[model samples]
Target chain A: MKQWYRDTGLQARMFLTMFLLAAVYLAFISFLATTGVGTMGIVVVAGIFIFIQYFYSDKLVLWSMGGKIVSESEEPELHTIISRLCQIADLPKPRIAVVENNVPNAFATGRSKKNAVVAVTTGLMHQLNHGELEAVIAHELSHVKNRDMLVITIASFISTIAFFLARNLMFFGMMGRGRRDSGGIMAVWIVSILVWLVSFLLIRALSRYREFSADRGSAAITGQPAQLASALMKISGTMKRVPTDDLRKVEGMNAFFIIPAVSGSSLMKLFSTHPQIEQRIAKLEEMQQKMEF
Target chain B: MGFLDAFLGKTKLPKSKTKDIFAISTANVTFEVNLNLRALNKAGICFKPQASSHFTQARAEVEELLAYSCKDTNTGYQITKDAYGYTWIVLEDPDFEDLVSNIYLVSEGLIERDFGEQLLCALFTFKEKGGANVYWIYNFKHGNFYPFAPKANKERNSAFEFRLRSVMEKELPIEKDVERWYPLWDVPV
Candidate 1:
């Protein structure tokens, strides 16, 4: 049997981070319950926020990037490769999308695999060969298989609530008065800030691990890690040649892009959705080497 | 998705699996008894070729040795590369049992030569009421058999394939993962 390489260390750290995040959320909920901000109010508001993100963020992301869903006839080759990858991944075929841009990159985002979408830019089709393109598609499909979108959404929920709490306490003042009056607000503020700070790094670290795991998933589905490595090289190599004007076109949605590109969301945020190109390529190469044994 | 499994990103559900492809040979009787499917007595092993000189030499040796061993029998083999770059070593013989043995011998030769990882899959074709091709692919990596019957360009006869699996499931170690049933379009068998 094909024995896939697993990064137990990375997996353990990810689990620990999630465990700690859960703990922090538990304490935050308890704080909310006692501090008398009407936990119901916060829950309703958070629920609405998450509900919108869960259901509609995909459309918003697609629209913002100027992507349109293509029929199978228009891109049969793409559909064929994706269908094969799905079978190998045991994933239901997700909706396929194509953005009319010159960027040689792709990403997968949706609430789940059944309703998921894998979009590749026009340039990516031109840039990669069949094997390389298959690798990218496999990577995106792996994200769907691993449910990275949902994990990131949940992680986003935790941070959004923390940010919301901290901001409300800072600007609009505390809701219900607790036993300690001003002291309760201060305590909530400290907790929110701590959660926010920790989650910023923690979430970014998780994002990086998700990228690595997705790379591994791609290897598993395609059975060719080197194809992904070469695809990364070709994309990154051409990423430099694609011109700044074109890069700025998709800059608004760079956070969700596969490469975690330039000109948006501070070049060095402690958190990013995609891993570095060098590191991703290296990971795929390592996977390729390990699969030999 | 338990709280911990979801946290650890265990959402990628593992599909069904198998390892002993010899089960395919053993399971052929069920196909004939139940589904009216007959072995075509033509089988092939599809593999991605390594770029090494040793691999090239080993492939040539396999071809030569098979030709020598089956000189008296009608066993014949040919190596053809598909458009997608995978090499198919096709074997043919009227005796169904001989085809399986010949396939096994060639596969073992490749594995003994340390080209095991390069071996992708072995396939044995089956026929329904008429002369329509139904291929059962044995994945070398997973060591399981899955049915693949491509209709047109990349379209699969999945409904019929599921029926084929039902017939063979009891006797063969069928691949549980529906995802692993990769189609070999326009296969020359």
Candidate 2:
């Protein structure tokens, strides 16, 4: 049973990242209290926004992708693949939606396992053969199984709050009345910015870690990591050839996609919601090797 | 899934509970005595047949086993591919117990061969006094039973299904989440 899914290094990094995020969040909140910043209004506003976004995230994602939920009759092959994977993964069947795009990507969204929706682009179906497509769909199902939507939403909550505080503090710092007051406001503003920056990077790192974990899940479910690796390679290879206009249209959903629409540059890599395709494929290949042995 | 497990994306494949299907065999007595529902002498195991050669080999082994076992019980079985791309192993026998055990045998056979996850659900057909079809679907993964009474025009008789649930909830492991009571439209049983 303990064949290949365990990754001690990955787990350690994920735990450390989460621990650092929590520490940053706590320090920021305490700093706000010490400065008497009156965060009740901000907390309430952010709470309401995140709540709605979390609750309706599946619908929001589907709408943004222009995905239409397809019935079994419409896409029996897709449904069959998803249902079979769901059975293997011990997950309830999630609603399957199809987007009429030539982007060759897929994503899973929902607040919880029961409410999840998995959407794949038309191009993915047209491009991948049976095993490759099943591998990709299994990867999306892993996101649903791991509850990536809920985890990412909760992790980003503090980043959002810190961002809001930083922006509002910036305006207040500019309009200060006295030197001493301005100095105090300046210190708080810097702390908020620092908190925001740290949380944002941590969140990105956490998202990348979740991606690796989901890949492992796909490996576990399908028992074929090499297929998923091949699928990822094909999608990434196809992504480069897709029109820039098409990539730009779906770029906003990079975090949820099987492969981000854009890649390159170390600076962009640091902020990327998904790990680089080469790195992901490498890990999957390693898993495949372990399973084979 | 635990909090830490979810955080780590660790999951175990759920074990198939083909054994729990025996509950339906005993519950048939209650159905006949009180609900005026009679077993249609037909039950089938619907599964998504894999395209791989190994699955074909496993299924062939299951067929060979079924053929060998049915010879002794006088139970008749047929394998038919449905329009919806699912393979149904339909079993017929005057003895309802034989029908139940045969369905169980086929599922167990596949499971033992490591193709158990491909078995979708086991469906047993029953009829009401007026010739209306009522169905009991046993989800292999979940190990729960759900009533599916299909009406004409692609509709379900939820009221009647609910009554069946309420009545048999004590004797059978009925699936509580109605959302998971997926309808098997045009089931070839």
Top of the candidates by TM-score: 2
Candidate that scores best on DockQ: 2
Off-target runs (Cα >4 Å) in candidate 2 are A6-8, A35-44, A69-96, A129-134, A176-178, A222-227, A238-268, A285-293, B33-40, B46-68, B71-93, B106-119, B127-133, B151-160, B186-188
Model 1, B3-72: lDDT tens per residue? 4544565424243232475677667777778877788889987766644456678888887777875675
Computed on C-alphas against the true complex, the DockQ of each candidate is 0.20, 0.31
| Total backbone collisions for each predicted model | 1, 0
Q: Native-contact fraction for each model?
A: 0.13, 0.35
Candidate 2 residue pairs in clash (backbone atoms < 3 Å): none
Model 2 earns a TM-score of 0.78
lDDT scores for all predictions? 0.73, 0.83
Which stretches in model 1 have alpha-carbon errors above 4 Å?
Answer: A1-4, A55-73, A90-92, A169-183, A238-269, A285-293, B1-38, B47-74, B101-122, B127-131, B136-183
